[model samples]
Target: MNLKLKEKIRESLSAVLPITGIVLMISIFLIPMELGTIVMFLTGAIMLIVGMGFFQLGAEMSMTPIGEGVGVQISKLKKLITVLLTGLIMGIIITISEPDLQILANQVPSVPNMVLIITVALGVGLFLALALVRIRYKISLSVLLIICYAALILTSFFVPKEFLAVAFDSGGVTTGPMTVPFIMAVGVGLASVRSDKNSADDSFGLVALSSIGPILAVLILGCFYKPTQAAYVLEDVETVVTTQDVARIFARGLPLYAREVLIALLPIIVVFFIFQMLTGRYHKWQIRRIMIGFIYTYIGLVLFLCGANVGFAPVGAYLGKQLAELSFNWILLPLGALIGYYIVKAEPAIQVLNHQVETVTNGAISVKMMDHCMSIGVAASVALAMLRVLTGVSIHWFVIPGYFIALVLSRFVPDIFIGIAFDSGGVASGPMTSTFLLPLSIGVCEALGGNLMTDAFGVVALVALTPLIAIQLMGLVYKLKTGKGTPTERAVIADDCDMIVDLEEDE
Candidate 1:
């Protein structure tokens, strides 16, 4: 195995083991899962470990380089129109490449998948263009976020109740593995042209801004499309019994997800070739490496989708239903919180975002610290999501207050931290949230006979929302500790070689 791949797989195991342990404990102590279900969950855990490892490496090798190349090219455009057009086009392509978006779209039965996907893509494209412009000219990330979110909030009232949660969730799913590396890299590439103290700060918000676009787009879509009850294809956990059965199960799943992933990657591959042809930015060796990276990303995604959707989702739903039906169902809150705390560590994009933040911030924002903050955030979000699932409360109660706090803190944190805090909100809810958390919530909701759309669907959005506040709170602590300076100046260590990847050398 490649050394980097081995390291990534090792890191993934570190993230996965705790969650697997938690699930096993739940099955053993809290609830007795069927043997087949236990086997399925374990298989899924194995796949998640390997898939996440591959995905993270792929992002490093393929997505990051491509984003950097494109960002630089976009920044080099003389005409604003050219830049905007490029950003718009690239945003749509990359958003289409996102696996989480497809997962979310599939769950939504009211709107056609392609229609929802395209709308979200358009939204991401528009805001991505705006984000590029913001970086080019150095606009206030806080101000832009406020305006975009204010518009989003105002628009929500006009959207139907049934469709509201899904709308917000559209925002969350867009910031997954596929979009982040490209979006963040574009930010880095655009920022690279400038030699300013704030360039890094500006580089942080593209993901933040891009996250908003999908929500706004989907909300507008909700106005025209009346959402009905969601139709979920809950997996049957008892279908596979033995190791051969599991292999057959995974084998059956692999091709469909493989085809989907390949289709998702096709546009990006085209973009890569186009970038090479138009700019001659890559050497032949670079091209070869990139193609290899694409292959890694494809394989990783197929395995991940199979593990998450085929292997994990059914078990999550079953566990949720079992737990919900228990005598002291209140355990769902803390249990959900515990799972939330660890499951986030397993999100491939969370690692990607953390590495980027740690690197760009010169280790001031260490990955360990990020993990802690995000775990806490996710814990709170999951607890709240479970609360909603149990009591049938309004999502508006959480969504409105959460964003308000997150935005308010944006005023206080360092500019780069503001960008990071917002983007982390999105990155925190990647494939794992889509596959496991949402299904878990839905299972609880179904067991309780609650409204699925209103009660359960917003788990992704909640997962997206809480991290903003949590991270910004951490940012406030950092500012108080460091006492007023640019994040670059406040760095605890200077460009820690181990944390930061050398993009130029890699390319």
Candidate 2:
């Protein structure tokens, strides 16, 4: 293998191992899972590590370049209408092809899968156009966020209560692995055209704003079509009694996921080719490299989704069922918190966000620090979610207050941190949250006889919420410690340069 692939594998191992070890410890000491289950879980972990390595490499090679190229080309057009139209088209196309959105649509049986998918796609498309406009006009990200969220909360009051959690969740899942790298890179490319001091800060909020679009769209749908109860049918895990059964299980799953991934990627590949043909942007060698990257992405997503859905999800549900049945069910809260702390690291998109943040900041904010902060944020969110399940607390009790605090914090933090915090909220809730954590919550809710829609369904929204506050708080600390010197110094330097230019002109 090449050295770059080796390095990616090593990174994947570090991210995956801790979570696997946590599961093993829980199985041995607390839950005592079946030997067959343990074997299957281990097998899945290996696939996850390998899959993540390839996916990360492919994203760096293909998604980043494609997004940046499109962004730069669109910006160069210098026509607001052209930019808006391009954003709308690209956003809908990409959201339609997101694998996670497909999973989310399947879970919502009230709306036809196609209907939900299209609604969410339209939401993403509209808001993505708004985001590009915001960057072009140098709008205040915090103000935009506050207004959007406030409107979202107000809209929830008119919708059926059952749809609230799902609406918020739509916001979270829309910014999944397929969407994040591409959307973020587009922001970077858009910002690259500007020579302003705040351009870098502006690039960070595209994912954050894109997340909001889904919430608003879903809420509007809720006003029209109300479901009294969510129609969520949990998938049954097939029993595996031996190593051959484990192999058989994965083999059976492989083709299904492979097909799904291929369907998800086809549009993206078509878009890339169209852009290449129209712009002649990439040379033959570069095109060849991108094609190879697409292959890696295809294989990686197939393996990753198969491992997550077939392997990790069943075990998560099983573990939740077992734990909730125990004499002291309250233990789920702390245990969930522990799992959340480690599990965020395993999210492929979280790694992408962390690395991007570090790179954008020129290592001013290290990846390690971002990782630690996200872990704490996610841990708090999960613990709160588990508490809601155990006590039958309404999601609004937590979400309303949680978002209010996050919005308030946005006012105090540096502008860049505000954008990062909101974006992190979306990134922190990725495939692991959907496949593993959502199933786990559903299992516990089922065992506890709680309302699945009201109790278990909002975990993704919560997972997406706490990170906003945690990351902004980190920014607040950095601002306090550093005395906000950078922005201030830049302003002073700009003033001096202006004065010198005037003097030279006068001379």
The runs of at least 3 residues in candidate 2 whose Cα sits more than 4 Å from the true structure, single-residue gaps closed, are: 485-507
Candidate 1: misplaced stretches above 4 Å? 485-507
Tell me how candidate 1 scores on lDDT.
Answer: 0.86
Writing each residue's lDDT as its tens digit, candidate 1 over 1-507 gives 999999999999999999999999998898898787788888888998999899889888999998888878887789999989988998998898887777778776688988988999999999999998898888899999989888999999999888888788778877888888888888888888889899888878898889999999989989898878786677767566678998888888899998889888998999888878889999999888888888888888788888888878888898889899999999999999999999999998899999998988889889988998899899999999999989888888999988887888787678988999888987887889888998899889888889988988899899999989878767766665566756763453223221222321242
Tell me the TM-score of each prediction against the true structure: 0.94, 0.94
In terms of lDDT, the poorest run of 10 residues in model 2 is 496-505
Per-residue error (Å), model 1, residue 309: 1.0
- CA lDDT, candidate 2, residue 261: 85
lDDT tens string, model 2, 264-343? 89999999999998999999999998888888888878888888888899888888888999998898988999999989
